[model samples]
Target: MALKTFVKISNISNLSDARYCAGMMVDVLGFNIDPNSSTHVAEDDFKEITEWVAGVKFAGEFHDSSIEQIKEAIKKYPVDYIEIADLDLVEKVGLLGKPLIFRLSITNEEDLSKIKSTLSYLDELTKLVLFHCDNENLFDQIDAQIGFYNGNLKLMKGYGITADVSLGNFPGLALEATEEDRPGFKDYGQIMDVLELIEED
Candidate 1:
C-alpha cells in the first residue's frame, strides 16, 4: 500500500510496528536510539527489527544525547536520518553528514516564534521539521505560516492530523507507533484509521 504523501512513524520499538509501517509504505521509521531513553531500542533489537523491513529509511531518534553519544550510537546501527528534538543541537548533529529531522513541540506564541526564527536559518542538510502543537488551533496557526517559511526543509504537521486531513502547504504528517499489548497481538487504534484514509488509490 502506498501513501498519498510523505509519512513518518516515530518511536517504533517492535518488529511488528517496523514491518507494518514498512508495508504501509511510510517514508521513514524512527527508533529511539538514546540509551537514556526508556523506549530506547538496543543495537541487537534494532538490527533484528530493521533486518526484516525493506523499502524505507531509518531514523536514529535522539532526544537529549550528546554529539559524541549520537556519533557512537550510529556507528553501531547506521541510519539514513538523524532525528533530534533540541534545536540547539542541529548544527552539531548536521556535522555527522546525515539528513536531519528536527522535532519540536510548540505550546505557545513564544515557542512558535523561537522555532520559526531558528528554522529560517537552517541549512539544506535539514531535511524535515516536524511540529507538534498543543492543540488543533495552534496547528492551524503553524499551517498558516508555511508560505512565509523560506527554508528548504519540508514541514510536517505532527499534531492535529485526522483521517480527513487537508495537507495544504505541508508535505505530510507524522505519527507515533503504538506499543503492542502482548507479544503477538496489537491494537493499531487511530493510526490504522488514518493510514487507511490516506492510502494511495
Candidate 2:
C-alpha cells in the first residue's frame, strides 16, 4: 500500500516499527540518535532494525547533541538525513554534508519571528522544516504562516494532523511510530488509522 502524500514516521526504535512503516510505504523513518534521549537507538539496534527494512529513507534525530557529538554519531550511525531542533546548529550541521530536517517548535505568537528568520538560514542542504506545536491553538496560529513559506524548503505540519486535515499548501504530514506491543507484534494504532485514511489505490 502507498500513502497519498509524503509521510515521515519519527522516533522509531524497534524493528517492528521500522518494518511496519516501510511496508506502508512511508517516505522517511526516523530514529532517535541522541544518546541522552530515553528512546535513543544505539548503533547495534539501529543496524538490526534498519537491516530488515527497505524503500524508506532513515533519519538521525538529534535534540541536544553538540556538533562534535553529532559528527561522532554520524560516523557510527549512518543515516540519510539529520533531524535537529536548534536553529543555531543549521549552518554548522549543514557543513557535515547531510540533508537536514529542522524540527521547529512553536508555542506562541512571539515565535513567529523566529520561524520567519529560520527560513532565511535554510540553505540547499536543508531538506525541510517540521513544525511541531505544543497545542492546537498554537498550531492554528502557526498554520496561518504556512502560505508565507514559498521558498525551496518543504514545510510539514507536525501537529493537529487528523485523517481529515485540509493539507492545503503543505507537502505532507509528520507522524510518530507507536511503541510495539512486543518485539514482533504491534497495535499499529493511530498511525495505521491515518495512513489508511489517506491510502491511495
Candidate 3:
C-alpha cells in the first residue's frame, strides 16, 4: 500500500543527519524535544538544524510536559506541529494553534476505549495519529479499528512505508521504541546512498 512516510529523528544532534533527511524529501520530521528523553535534542541544536532544512514538516515531540514547558520550547525552537504521547495531555496543548500528532500505545483489546476517547477528542484538535505496540500483529489489529471511527482524521502508516519505509520501519520493527522514543532513533546513515536509492526507486 502507498503511505505517507514520517521519519522520526530523535535528538537531531547534528547538521549532517538533518541535511540528509531534509534533502531526502521525507514527508514528516519528528524532533524529540522532551528534556527527559535520552535522545532529546537541545533547542539550540534543533534551531540550528531546522534553519538549514526546508520543504519539510516538523513536529515537536513531548511526553507529559506542561504547557509552559512546550511554550518555552516553542519560543526557542518552534515546530510546524507538536506530537504528544500521553493521551491525557491532549486538550492541554492542542489549542496552541499548531496541528497535533496524538501518539497512542495500545497493548491489547482492552485499551480500545481509551484509544477511541482519544480519537474522539482529537476530532477538532488534530488530523494525524500514531499507534504503537509491542506486538506487530496487535498493532495491525488495533490499526484496523481506524475504520470504525467516522472522521476525516488521517492515520500515519510507516515502511512496514521508502526509498519505499525500510528506514521508517526500523524502530517499530525492532520493537525497541517506546512512546518516549518515537521521535525516532538517531542511527545515522550515508545521505548520497539514500538519494541514489530514491532515484532508482
Candidate 4:
C-alpha cells in the first residue's frame, strides 16, 4: 500500500489535464469553486469535466464559502471531500457528514497549541489535515516537541511540498504544481500510509 496524493486543479482551463491526470491514477481531484479565485472553475464546466473524471475522488476546493454556498456547490459537484483553508468554517460545514481536508497554518509555539486543539476535534470530524507554512518539518517538530497525537487525525504535508522529498509520518502531499514536472501518480489501494500522489507528473 503506497501513500496517496491529490492534485489541486485550481483552474481546469485545459480539460484534457483532468482526463490525463485521472488516467495517471491520481487519487483525488480538486477544483476551485470560489468565484473570485484566479483559477476558479465555472459550475457548468466543472460539472462537465467531472463527468469525464472517473475512478478517483474529487473535492470542491473552497476558499471561504458560506454554508449556503457549500450546499449549492454540493448539488452540482457532489464531491467526496470538502477542501478548505478556513479554520472558522470547519465545524459549520463538517457537521454535514462530508469528510474534510483542512489546510492549517502554524508559525510559532502558540499556534501549535491551537493546532493541537484543532486536531483533537478534527481527529473526530474529518479525513485528514494538510500542514501548510514555510516550516518544512512543522508537522514532525510539533509531534516531537508536544507529543501531540490524535488517534483519528491523519496528517499530510502541504505549503511547499515537492515530489522528490521524503515524507516522514506524513504520508500525503498537497500540490498546486501542473505541467510535466509534477510528481507522478499513485494507483488506488487502501488510502495509503506514507505515499500519496500529486495528480500528475
> Ranking under lDDT, best-scoring first?
1, 2, 4, 3
Per-residue lDDT for 1-201 in model 2, tens only? 788888889999888888878998999999999976877888999999999999999999999999998999989997999999987788899999888999988877788767767776774558688888867777665767787778788887788877677677788789888777887888888788888887898
lDDT of 3: 0.61
Tens digits of per-residue lDDT for model 3, 1-201: 112233444334566666666676655677788866777887777887788988777788887677788878777767888888776677777777788887776766787657667777777777777666665656555545665666766665431322333432222211111232233344444333334454424
Instruction: Quote the lDDT for 97 in model 4.
Output: 69
C-alpha lDDT values of all predictions: 0.85, 0.84, 0.61, 0.64
**Which clashing pairs does model 2 show?**
none
lDDT per residue as tens, model 1, 1-201: 699889999999898888888998999999999977887999999999999999999999998898899999999988999999876788899999899998878888787677767677664558798887756567767777775776677887788777677778788789888789987688887778788898988
lDDT score at residue 71, model 3, on the 0-100 scale: 76
Off by over 4 Å in 4: 1-13, 36-38, 135-150, 178-201
lDDT per residue for candidate 4 within 1-201, as digits (tens), equals: 222443333333335667765666666777787655766777787778788778778777888678788878777777788888887788888877678888777787777768667877777668778777777556567545334463666676565444354455555655442432333443323122223333223
The TM-score measured for candidate 3 stands at 0.71
Number of residue pairs clashing in candidate 1, backbone atoms closer than 3 angstroms, sequence gap of 3 or more or interchain: 0
Model 2 bad stretches (over 4 Å): 123-125
**What clash count goes with each model?**
0, 0, 4, 6
How high is the lDDT of residue 64 in model 1? 83
